[model samples]
Target: MRLLLISNSTMAGEEYLDYPKNNIKDFLGDKPVKALFIPYAGVTVSFDEYEAKVKAKFNEVGHDIVSIHHFEDPVKAVEEAEAIVVGGGSTWNMLHLVHKNNLTEAIRKRVISENVPYIGWSAGSNLACPTIKTTNDMPIIDPLGFDALNLIPFQINPHYLDKNPDGHGGETREDRINEFMVVNTDMYVAGLREGSMFLVENGKINLIGKLNCRIFKNNVQAYELSPKDDFNFLLK
Candidate 1:
């Protein structure tokens, strides 16, 4: 399986997808591919608006994208796609539509069997995990099931922060994750900070950013892994 799972889209004061655009270019290669885009996670904006924004960014990087909604058969679209791109928004909404449209298996098959490239950010990254149980998104609605595409064995808490903002009395991100660990003791959860991403290909995985990824597991002390360290362990 091949995947580029990003933590977040835009960085502070930067253009949409600016920080990762070059990395995206490298991943897709110079041949240029018109990727199939899944934009169902976008609840506040129209699919067209979301598609346009992502399309503009992809085009700038010598690639192109078309929203899955454009096709009548979403499953068939995934089957024929050379690459798949999932945009970030609401994790619940995205999985709901993905399950509603019955594209979960199709997506998994395409990426795993066909070796089609997969790129996702934020909630999109959450979609690639064994389950969306670790997602930070509020449960605005039911997703039909917590099961996701399960392209990756581990869980990713995208946009993970080390602490709550000053004056905020809410629980820290780690606290919530600790709660998850208590129940799912065997599973691994990676705190993927903003601007960082995971690159998986040919059964190997690598971290792509300056920041170190925070790792959490039950009974094990949380630790940090930098880009220089091997992330292949997560794949197993």
Candidate 2:
């Protein structure tokens, strides 16, 4: 299986996908690929608009994409897709539509079984985990089930932060994961901060970006790991 799970698409003041465009280009390689894009996570933006924004970035990097919405048979689209790309938005909406379309298994077969490259960011990244329970998105819509694609064994908390905004008394990100660990004791959760991502290929995983990813597991002290650190342990 091959996956590029990004924490977030854009930085505070950066252009949309500007930081990862080159990483995307390198991941897809020199040969231009017409990736099949899943834009179901989009809520406020129309599918066309979402596709256009992503297409512009891929086009800039010598690749292109076609939104899955244009297909008559979504399952068939996944089966024949050269590569799969999922954009950021509300994970709830994305999984809702994914279950609604009966695409959960189809996607798993293509990416996990068939080795097609899979790329996702934010909510999209959350869908790659065993369950969407770790997502930061509100339950604006029922995801049909908490279970997700399960492409990776562990959970990813995207846009993870060390501290809450000033004066905000809400639980820190770590506190929530601690709550999750109390019940799901064996699971691992990676606090993927902004500008960081994980690259999984051939069953090995690597962290990408300058920032250290905070690792959390029950009964173990949560700690930070730099990009140079071996992340393959997470796959175990």
Candidate 3:
């Protein structure tokens, strides 16, 4: 199975996952590609509309777009897909949707049993983490308990920013990430900037992106990766 976790929407628009389409060939070996997008977490587009747009985005990226499905009936979608890509958005909102649709176990089972390639960005990346304790977005709503699919043992704060120049200056993204680490020492935190990705191929973890991926343990900097770094601990 292969898992691609991006920090955010690829290039910042509705076609947010274009970069992965170009680079995914590097990891797929010779297997044919089939992808699914879960847009339940996004606030803007309806899942059906997002599905249509994602297909176009896939074509724009030059991949043979097999199908683009929504999250309402994800199990059926997974059954028909060889790969799955969940788009970026609010982590809390996504988790709420996941719980609402009861898709956690279904997705995990497919990834673990069927070896389906799983791809996600931002909120999707956060879902791969142990829990959703490091998102920098305002807590507009809470699902009571912020949890995740635990695909990786560590906690991941995707799209991590060191500074937000909006003038609020309340707290840097790094500071919020650090706050999450204070109570969860057993879990590692990956502070990924935009364009960053964590890939799991054949169950191996590879850090792929343009920026350094900051690793934190006990609220301390454990290490950083510029690009194509191996983070097998996440897979372990």
Candidate 4:
């Protein structure tokens, strides 16, 4: 999959269009962009206004925008799309909606078959894992199924190392991911610092950002990165 996976909304050294979008802009490089911003829990914007805003973003980037919602025809959406950007939300909820709308396969086909790039940030990144069972957020309700798109074999716990004054929480993001690693022995974890991203070029995974990245195997620190490099080990 030509996936642009970002850790969070903040881009590297900038606060404009979120981390993932920055990666996308680089990969697209003047190519037309069409996005599908998966809706929030109870948003009330009409389709026309949504389309207008989408058009605006595309126009700002000199791309085209084709607006589609979870409630609409996903097949048509994927077909018309040259590139797709999935926004952040509840992982369980978004996966359920994807399955409910029978969009998982169609989206995969678009990315894998049609060669369209798929950009996901936050919960969108979570959905690209093999399964969503290990996410830090409580799965409020069981989805149609928790199976991920499996774009990448490994699981990514984005937004790692949040700085908080009070250190009290049920479990740290790393802790939760460790719990999953204990059971799933094969998958590697990429601890993406905020503003960092995983870029898929020619079906290879590479690290892009201005920060160091940590690699985890069975929750143990494997290595750290400060230089710009492509992670072929993860791809293998």
Q: What is the lDDT of candidate 4?
A: 0.69
| Predictions in order: lDDT | 0.95, 0.95, 0.70, 0.69
On residues 48-106, what C-alpha lDDT tens digit does candidate 2 reach at each position?
A: 99999999999999999999999999999999999999999999999999999999999
TM-score of each: 0.99, 0.99, 0.84, 0.83
Worst 10 residues of 2 by lDDT: 227-236
Evaluate model 1: give its lDDT. 0.95
* Model 2, residue 64: C-alpha shift (Å): 0.3
TM-score result, candidate 2: 0.99
Candidate structures ordered by TM-score, highest first? 1, 2, 3, 4
- Clashing residue pairs, candidate 1? none
Task: List the pairs of residues colliding in candidate 2.
Answer: none
**In terms of lDDT, which candidate is stronger, 3 or 4?**
3
lDDT of 3 by residue, 1-236 (tens): 66777787666663556677666655444555656667766666776676676667665544434333333466677667667777776777778877766777778888777887777777888887767787666665665477777777887787777678877758777676667677776677888888777777766777777789888878456677766666787656
Better of 3 and 4 by TM-score: 3
User: What is the descending lDDT order?
Assistant: 1, 2, 3, 4
The CA lDDT at 228 in model 3 is 61
